[model samples]
Target: GAGVSQSPRYKVAKRGQDVALRCDPISGHVSLFWYQQALGQGPEFLTYFQNEAQLDKSGLPSDRFFAERPEGSVSTLKIQRTQQEDSAVYLCASSKTTGPGYTFGSGTRLTVV
Candidate 1:
């Protein structure tokens, strides 16, 4: 992909179902980040990756939240035991080694019902 790409732009999950969101970054991009944006609030960083190594995940709210970028170009965010409070727009971004700005993908709107 020439830019960051996310799939299933909208998702609706039953209360206990788990969901996996995918992100494909631009070719050669070295940095990737995941964020969760709640309604009426700014995006909150969830995790960051430099190439295939996950550098930070301190912002992940709970053990059920997980993110990974393996082989360096693509990533996935998985949430277990979906809950209403977890509903938010999950955003994925990529940059060139800490570039001042990132190219963000159209977020995946997750709705837990």
Candidate 2:
């Protein structure tokens, strides 16, 4: 089975630009989650989707952040009008169920200038 993976392990963006990062979850997984982790801080939940249905998105910081899991597997997180504060490691994880553990991608490190 394929493990979760994320692209552009590092990114540098100028403030006010838009960026899109991609994530590929494991096959047949029913739950997917996105999180943001600031330097030296724990990962914070950003959103979650069960298949193509978005189950939760309470943790998205602002309107600038948006995510989607269209095909019930692959997902993308897009940031509009990037700001310095948006700099962080964006992580994606998936699980067979809402169980205890999840498989996480390496994450995309975004740096807003």
Candidate 3:
């Protein structure tokens, strides 16, 4: 893909349910990041992966939030036991390296009821 692609543009999950959001970044991008965006605020970093190694997951709000990039290209952000507070837009971004700006995906909006 020419740009970052995220699946299931929107998702509605019942409370306690689980959801997985997928992101396919540009070819050869070595750095991938996941962020959470509330209704009106800027996106907050959740996790980052360099190649297949998860370098930082400190921003993830809880243990229920997990992110992975198994092959260093496509990534998935999974939320376990969804909660109402988890309703937000999950954004995925990728860059060639740490020195350059990233290309962001359209995002997957998750609503927990």
Model 3 clash pairs? none
Sort the predicted structures by TM-score, highest score first. 3, 1, 2
lDDT, candidate 1, 38-64, per-residue tens: 999999999999999999999999999
Per-model C-alpha RMSD: 0.9, 0.9, 0.7
Regions of candidate 2 where Cα sits further than 4 Å from its true position: none
Q: Which clashing pairs does model 1 show?
A: none
* Tens digit of per-residue lDDT, candidate 3, span 2-60: 99999999999999999999999999999999999999999999999999999999999
Q: Could you tell me the lDDT of residue 33 within candidate 1?
A: 94
lDDT, candidate 2, 39-108, per-residue tens: 9999999999999999899999998899999999899999999999999999999998986499999999
lDDT of each: 0.94, 0.94, 0.94
Pairs with steric clashes in candidate 2: none
Q: For model 3, state the Cα shift of residue 89 in Å.
A: 0.3
What is the alpha-carbon lDDT for the whole of candidate 1? 0.94
TM-score of 3: 0.97
Candidate 1 TM-score, true structure as reference: 0.96
Candidate 3 Cα misplacement greater than 4 A, ranges: none
